[model samples]
Target: MTEQVYACIDGSVSTRTVCDYAAWASQRLSTSLTLLHVLDKESYPVAADYSGNIGLGSQEQLLKQLAALDEERAKLAIQHGLHMLEAARERVKSDGVANAGCMQRHGDLVDCIVEQQGDMRVLVMGKQGAGETHPGRQVGTHLESVIRTLHRPILVSTGTFKAPERVLFAFDGSQTSRKGIERLVSSPLLTGLQIDILLVGADTVEHKEQVKWAANTLTAAGFNVPNTAIRAGEVDEVIQHYCQQEKMDLLVMGAYGHSRIRQFLVGSTTTSMITKSTIPLLILR
Candidate 1:
C-alpha cells in the first residue's frame, strides 16, 4: 500500500492545527498528505420505531417522513464533510503541501481508521473531538480507542502548530522505549532536530546507562543529542517538568500496554502524557 500521512479533521477548533502538523510531518517524511473526515454513525440515527403509536396510515406516513428527514441529514453531513476536507486540503497547500488528497468515510472514527490503516504512515488527530466541550479530561473520546487499535505512529495536536526544533523523548529502559528509539533512528520524522532524553527513575548506574544508550543511538543516527537527564520523581511530574524547563516543542514516547486490565491496575504514562501535556505528542508503537 502507498504510505501517506493521514490527518483526521472534524471541523473542530483544532482542525487547522492538525492540518499544519500533518503537513509538517508529510514534508519531513517526504510523503503525500491525505485529509480525512469521518461522519460518525451515531451522530445520525437511521430509523425510529413508531409501531402501535398511531393509525396504520399515519404511522406509515410518519415513518416515511422521518426516514426522509434522516436521509436529508445524512446528505447534509456528507456535504459538510466534503467541504471540511476541501478546506483542509487548501490549508495544507498553503503550508507548502500541494496536491494533497481528500477522503471522507462514514462510520465510527476508530473503525474507519482501522480500515484505512493499511495506507497510513502516520495519523494526525486533535486532542479533543467535536463533541467534547468540557475540559474535564483533555483526550478525545475516540483518541484512546484509535491509539489502541491502530499500529501506526500517531501525532496528536494539543494546540496551534509551530515548527518543532527541540524534541524530548521520555525513555524508561523498557523494551517499548528501546523500540521507540530504534524507530526514531529509522524514520525521518525527527531528523536534524535536537533531542533531549529524559528518564524518570533512580539516578543509579543502570538508569544512567540506559540514558546513555538512547543518546548514543540517536547521535549515531545523525540526530543532535544535546542533553540526557535521569531525574528521580513521579513519572508524569518529572517528564512534564523537564519538557517545560527545557522548552521542548514535541514529546515522543512509546505507547504503553494494550491490555485494559493493565491500564486499569496501573495507569499508563502514554495516556497521562496525552492528557496533561500542552505540547504535541508523537506516540510510537
Candidate 2:
C-alpha cells in the first residue's frame, strides 16, 4: 500500500485549483498522485418508482422507459468522469508529477474515500463541488462530510493556485491543535515555507505558552516559523484578518471536533474558515 496524494476532481470550477494544489503536495511529499472521480449516487440517482396504479401496463412501460433513461444517464456520467480524470492527470503531469494514477468509483464520495484511504497520504479537493451553483461562500455539500470521515489531512482549494510561499497555522492549546502541529512538522509538504503560528482567543498565559510550544516545535523540526502571535478576538475574525494582513497563501488548522448541537449554538470555526477564507485551507485530524 503505497502512500499517494489523492485529488478529487469533479469537473467543478475548482477542479483546476484542486489539481494544482494536489500536484504541489505530491511534489513536496515526493509521492505518487492519484486523480479520483467518484460517481456519487445522489448525483445520478436511480429511476423514480412509478408504482402508483395508473394502470399496470402503462406503469410497466413507463418504468421500463425510465430505467432505460437511467442507464443512458449512467453511461454518460461514466464517460464524463473518465474525461475529468484524464484531464486532471494531464494537468498534474504538466505540473511535474509524472505517471499520475486515475480512479473512478461508483458510490458516495465519503465511502469511496474510506475505501481508498489506505493508500492516501493526503487528500486535495475543491471547496465547492460541481453541484454548487450559487458560487459565493457556498461549500460543496460533501466537503464537511469528507473532512469529518477521513482521518488524513485534507487540503481544501479555493480561488486560484499559487505556490503557497507563506502559511498560517491557526493554533490553540488543545490536544487536537498540538497534534496538528506535530503532523505538520512530520510532513514535508510545507517544509520550506514560512508559517506563522497564531492563537486566536484570549492572550492569556496558556495561549501564549501554546503559541510558544508550536513555534518551538516547528523551529526544532527545521521549519521557518517567522512569527507567532496570540491575539484576543473571535477565532474566525482574527484568522481571517491575519491572513489578509499577512498575505498568507495557505491556512492550516485542526478539524473541528465539536458535536452538532454545540456547533449549532456557537457556529463551527472550521466551517467558518473554509467558507470565509479566500486562501486555501489545510485541515488536519
Write candidate 1's Cα lDDT for 1-285 as tens digits. 679999999998889999999999999999999999999889855444555555766468877777678778888889988999989999999999998999988878899998888989999999888888854256777888887778889999977789999999888887667888999999999999999998887899998988999999999889999999988887678888998999999988776654321242135555676777889988775
Cα deviation in Å at residue 118, candidate 1? 1.2
Worst 10 contiguous positions by lDDT, candidate 2 = 259-268
- What clash count does candidate 1 reach? 0
Predicted candidate 1, C-alpha RMSD: 2.9
lDDT of model 2 at residue 156? 92
Worst 10 residues of 1 by lDDT: 258-267
Q: TM-score, each model?
A: 0.92, 0.91
**Candidate 2's residue-wise lDDT over 160-244, tens digit each?**
9999999998877777678778888888999989999988777788778878999999999999999999888767788889999
Give the lDDT of residue 214 in candidate 1: 96
Candidate 2: the clashing residue pairs are none
249 Cα displacement, candidate 2 (Å)? 0.5
